[model samples]
Target: MQISFEEFVTARGPALLRFAYLLCGDRYLAEDVLQEVLARAYRRWSRIGGAPEPYLRKAVLNQYLSWWRRKSSSEALVATVPDRVQAYRTADELAARDEIWTLLATLPRPQRAVLVLRYYLDLSDSEIAELLGYAVPTVRVYAFRALGRLRAALSGRAPTTEARSG
Candidate 1:
């Protein structure tokens, strides 16, 4: 199944953006990665053939992770945050979600990526493994360990597994 680049972007743009945003903590970085991925995907769309999602996802994740690796967090840097940010749901939900993200950021980078892909993006172990180029069992282990850390972090808070299920 051959798809024109425009058609592919029109179809998968939103989902890819959402995935990108969830993968990277910042909207700016997410959008940047999305653009970079799409540009590369467009160049290789013919070779990608049908089912470009996995390829696009892998490319996006790889690009994002690479950027994270090259960054010097404490080194001199200048970037402006938006003056007006879009509001997340309600105040409480927003606060809870922010807390969860903060806890997530505390985990090791690989653990955090695995958990975000597994739970927030709702990718299965196999899917995450494919995207991350890891073994299925490795994905499962990272996700499990990440979940354990999150549980420990939020045990006293309002985000127990029971609440998550309900």
Candidate 2:
């Protein structure tokens, strides 16, 4: 049975917001993405043919990618402490998170989306491929490339184009 938008939002809003935050890496943008997706979902609630969660998630991902693409060329640099940081923790972890996020933001949208869907959402490669309209092998390649960059960055090496060539 089709549930009302209110019910759907009440049940899934928090989870969706968390997913958005993971994808966007900013709480305010995450909230915006959720709101934007919910607004679209609201308009189509009656005509929606499937479970709305998938539709909502796909919308969030697409919305984030669109925003990223439009702003990427002019994106600003910012420095902030990670939320997970503790007073007792050394600066290394915090610095690592900053570097990671910086690198993550630099990633092509598809790579970021694949990594978020696969790792953040814990979806399988095939599932992520279907969700993102990629072939299974393509999904694996994106994951491989994204992880390679992250690994290289953490090791204090500049990410190389060698991964893209192979």
Candidate 3:
């Protein structure tokens, strides 16, 4: 069966935006990428076949990766500590999450993407590899390297040379 583009977006847009945000770690960039992907998808909406979600998601990933490639060197890093606000989570939990996000922002795009895809999205390595157009081994390698970096950072140690290489 087929669905209108508007109906699909109404149902899936928020989740797609969240996925893009996790992939890129920037809200504005994520929105831009999603908008661009949706616009292109709309142009050929009629032609899209069964389960457009996967195709649209992959498009967002590809767009973010390509944009990262083009702008990686020129991107600026800014560190700011957000004001503490009382919420459901404890202060320590919030601080830890902030620290982890900081570390995640430091990772290379592909490594960050792998980590987000594996953990946040809870996709298996094979599924991640297929989505990323990478071999399963490569996906594993990225996850390993990313996790190693996060572990080392959390433990206040430098990553090993092997982890630093790729």
Candidate 4:
């Protein structure tokens, strides 16, 4: 059975927002992009062919990428120190996460997306390929290259090779 918009949003909205935040690395922009995609999905609710979640996700990804492309030329780097949090996480965990987040931001958009999809979303190569409109091999390549970059970043080395576009 097809899911209603309200039901779908109620169940998946938080997860979608988290995904968006991971994608954009900005909570406010993530919310805005998710809202924009949700509005568009609502407008086309009747025509959307299968389960709406996938469509909504694709919409979110497309919207984020569109915004990134538009703003990339003018993007500037600003160093902001994260505030200390009184939470369950140890200082090491927080630092590692922060470091990874910073490294992720330095990656190219596609590589960052690939890493997010594979690690954060726990999707397989085939699934990511389908979601990102890439061939399976291309998806693997992206993942491989992204992981290499991340490893290099963590190890304080520059990426050894440039990522090949598939």
Which structure among the candidates has the greatest TM-score? Answer: 3
lDDT of 2 by residue, 1-166 (tens): 7788898899999999999988887777788778988888888889876598888899998888787667544545365554665787678877776778788876777888899998888999998988888899998988888888888877879878854432
lDDT, candidates in the order shown: 0.75, 0.82, 0.87, 0.82
Model 4 reaches what TM-score against the true structure? 0.85
lDDT of 1 at 65: 76
- Flag the better candidate by TM-score, 1 or 2: 2
TM-score of each: 0.76, 0.81, 0.89, 0.85
Clashing pairs in 4: none
Weakest 10 consecutive residues of candidate 1 by summed lDDT: 157-166
Tens-digit lDDT string for candidate 4 (18-136): 99999988777789889999998888887996677777887888888788778544545466565657689898988898888888887777777888888888999898888888898
Candidate 2 overall lDDT versus native: 0.82
Please give the lDDT score for candidate 1: 0.75
Give one digit per residue, the lDDT tens place, for model 3 in 38-75. 99999999898879998998899899889867754555
Runs off by more than 4 Å, candidate 4: 71-84, 162-166
Model 3 weakest lDDT span, ten residues long: 71-80
- Residue range 5-56, candidate 1, lDDT tens digits: 8987899988888878877766777898899889888777889978888778
